[model samples]
Target: MINYLHREQILPAPIEKVWAYFCDPKNLNEITPPDMKFEIVSGGDVKMYEGQVVEYRVEFVRGLRSLWLTEIAHVRENEYFVDEQRVGPYRFWYHEHSFESVPAGVKMTDHVTYAAPFGLIGDVVNAVWIRQRLNGIFDFRYQKIVELFGSVK
Candidate 1:
């Protein structure tokens, strides 16, 4: 089964500046929670581009590290970009980050479609734990972005 997650935030910054920040893979660590221990193991120095493959080392649960490999599947300048999992814990993962210029500033949106490993058991785990964990991760990202860029006002 595929699960979806969506979140939107408006920042008090121009679309160009916001796009630059999000397009750089290195900046991901800054927005992610410290406890997750998210780090780019390779291919993060250069800015994102189509077919770019990035590797990461992450500890989603404390002390349990996992290697995640993803490819930048699509890009459209300051409009949107998508990253799909090539190798990771998830059975499938595709994330789209979109940006638009709003009257207040830039409206950023995150849309994720993913499925956990296993079958019925995975769905049960997702319902009991994974879903909440994903929500918390995005919540941290939203707060961190607001702290870094300031809220739309």
Candidate 2:
């Protein structure tokens, strides 16, 4: 079954600043949890653009390292970008990052749609593990972003 996660955060920063930070593929490692050992294997040097491909290595399941390949499917400067998985542990993964200027600052939203592998077993795993793991990852990201960009208050 397909699963979805949506999150929004108001960052105390200008849209251009937040957009610049997110546009650099390398910044992903900065926001990701260090325990995951997330590393960009290649294709992370330049700013994100439609058709850009990025490869990464991360320890996700049972601490086993896995390779993830993704392509930037769509990009609208200072607005939004979508990335789709090409090769990864998941059966399918699509993530959209969007930004809007709010009275407080920049409102950033993350929308993720993904499906697990192994059918019924995958569903069970997601129910017990993957779901929480993904939440934790995003939680970490939120904290890191706040630390880097300051709080909305």
**Highest lDDT among the candidates is held by which one?**
2
> For residues 3-74, what per-residue lDDT tens digits would candidate 1 score against the true structure?
999999999999999999999999999999999999899999999999999999999888899999999999
For model 2, the superposed segments whose C-alpha errors exceed 4 Å read none
lDDT of 2 by residue, 73-108 (tens): 999999999999999999999999999999999999
Q: List the residue pairs that clash in candidate 1.
A: none
Clashes of each: 0, 0
Residue pair clashes in candidate 2: none
| CA lDDT, candidate 2, residue 139 | 97
Cα lDDT, model 1, residue 89: 84
Could you tell me the C-alpha RMSD of candidate 1 in Å? 0.7
